[model samples]
Target: MASRWIRPEVYPLFAAMGVAMGICGFQLIRNITTNPEVSVNKARRASGVVENFEEGVKYADHRLRKYVRNRSPEIMPSINSFFSNPERSN
Candidate 1:
């Protein structure tokens, strides 16, 4: 009898990993397609509008501050102070 290269016990593990990867890939595709921000950024990059780390950080900070301001008024002062002087907070 010829012996199989892969053991039978490992088949379930491989299948589970494959399923997890597929789910992750599907979620990534969904996000890329559904999010207008992502598409806009891609278009900007294609048009030679290069995005650097500092710009990305500033954008994220702006978005975070806006979200925090809307959802929780009490935390606005702390968030504002932190952004104003990030070095002291850390």
Candidate 2:
């Protein structure tokens, strides 16, 4: 029967590659956390848009509600029964 273990020569190569990848990952995380240019909040504030996550969500919800309200009366019945009565003609 043949041995299923990896060859010993490949272990050092794998170790070296792992060390290099670890160093790169550490540098990437350091750059992201310390760099203001990568920050979403900073970018939004710089553009004079003071809305936070909650406010942005609220605005989106308001807009969606307004659009649905305006269009519902005209389109609601068909939308509601689209799946319920799939046999109905288009």
How does each model score on lDDT? 0.69, 0.65
Off by over 4 Å in 1: 1-5, 40-90
Predicted candidate 1 versus true structure: per-residue lDDT over 25-78, tens digit per residue: 986985676543464465665766454667466545655577776574554778
Query: The CA-based lDDT of model 1 is what?
Result: 0.69
RMSD of 2: 14.1
Clash count, predicted structure 1 = 0
Error of 1 at 15 (Å): 1.0
Candidate 2 TM-score versus the reference: 0.39
**How do the residues 1-51 of candidate 2 rate in per-residue lDDT, one tens digit apiece?**
235566777889989999999999986885566443345466554776343
Backbone clash pairs for candidate 1 read: none
Which portions of model 2 miss their true places by more than 4 Å? Answer: 1-5, 40-90
